[model samples]
Target: MQITPDGNIVFILPAGPLGSLPISATIVNTWIVMTILVVGGRLITLGMGPAAPASRWHLALEILIEQIRKQIQDVGGGDPGRYLPFIGTLFLFILASNVLGVVPGFTSPTGSLSTAAALAICVLVAVPFYGIADQGLLGYLRHYLRPTPLMAPLNVLGEISRTVALAIRLYGNVMSGTVIVAILLSIAPLIFPILLQLLGLLTGVVQAYIFAVLAMVYIAAAQGDEPGAA
Candidate 1:
């Protein structure tokens, strides 16, 4: 494994049969991120008060809550505040993991397929759960067969495809950026690497935004909203 200038360690995929194991530095980093999402997010929620305080954590969390609330309102058009906790946590975790690649000795958990796939799967499952809770199971499933009974199978396929696409899109984008920069740094250890780093920063934010937007879309769809409605 070689450490890049960004401080991310790169491990080339192994060639042999043992390459498919679930355990790796990537997996470990993902577990740490998961822990942070659960523990840190819960603490933030538990500690929040209607009265304002000057604590940095509360201030930062307030900004995050506002951002998530706006995003949900823009896309969902309902009580976005209610979903802000989970949606905000998801956004923060993903944004953190994506940006973590810039830190030394840290690999972006999102650059790994397993991690991205796991997150996408969670979003997929959560949609149905939230939908059932909000709209009832019958209403949620009725959405699948909506407008035309013949399109139910296609709707099901579309749902699964969106989840797969979310995973693959994030994995491919981050992994490709890392690989390209590695190649560039190997060939020329100069100012061009800095340009690549700048580009990575932009790409990281875009990927995070795309993931969050798609997640809202899934949740909106689950609630029987028209695709173009929101």
Candidate 2:
């Protein structure tokens, strides 16, 4: 067993004008996770009939949707319908990626800083996008200068800092968990590692929830609403 759980390079493209580009295990695993989510989503939504008695899968999906809607409404203080799809997809993708690490040969893409950074960048962009959409461009830009024009640079810095924090927080947790598990396997009994694996699974779920919630909070803030408002 390896002492360090670094991502393996799966393939390297020939050097071009840009340079040789290597696809790492994290990228490959992320692709797998995306494919799984897309196919599973399609399968789950197929052949729906409103008049028919709901199957367990359908019922569970309904409950999940309702819960997400409620959470968005509570945090964002407006109609939740528009935000549902983006927030739901973020939760499910992260949840799936984290859980996939439990499999024997799979590593969570989130353990890689690059992957985490990419996800954070998406949220960073989305926050501004939604803010500008909700408030006009001038309205959204004016917030940075509120109270005083001198505070504008500080406000911009805060946004950048938060985006960096979001990436690091998720990457640190997932990577540390991965490293701890690897270290345990190297020095501890197999049974102990099994227990740690179980704990890691629970932690993975919690991390996913926290990441999604934080993203929602940031979005709500961008919308100029109290994050805790109903």
Assess each prediction's global lDDT (C-alpha) against the native.
Answer: 0.78, 0.85
lDDT of 2 by residue, 1-230 (tens): 43222448889988889999887787788899999999987788777687777778887889999988888888887988878888888888888988988898788988888888988998899898889999989988988896799999999999999999999998888888877888888888597788877888898899888888888888888778998786
Candidate 1 off by > 4 Å: 1-22, 34-52, 226-230
List the candidates' TM-scores in order.
Answer: 0.81, 0.93
In the order shown, the candidates' Cα RMSDs to the true structure are 5.4, 2.0
Q: For candidate 1, write residues 1-230 as lDDT tens digits.
A: 33222233334555587664334677668777788777877886674676745577878877877887888878876788767766776677788787777665667888888778988998899899889988988988998887899999999999899999999998888888778877888889787777887788789888888888788878977886654453
Candidate 1 whole-model C-alpha lDDT, 0 to 1: 0.78
lDDT of 1 at 181: 77
Please name the candidate that would achieve the greatest lDDT relative to the true structure: 2
State the displacement of the C-alpha of residue 94, model 2, in Å, after optimal TM-score superposition. Answer: 0.7
- Compared to the true structure, candidate 2 yields what TM-score? 0.93
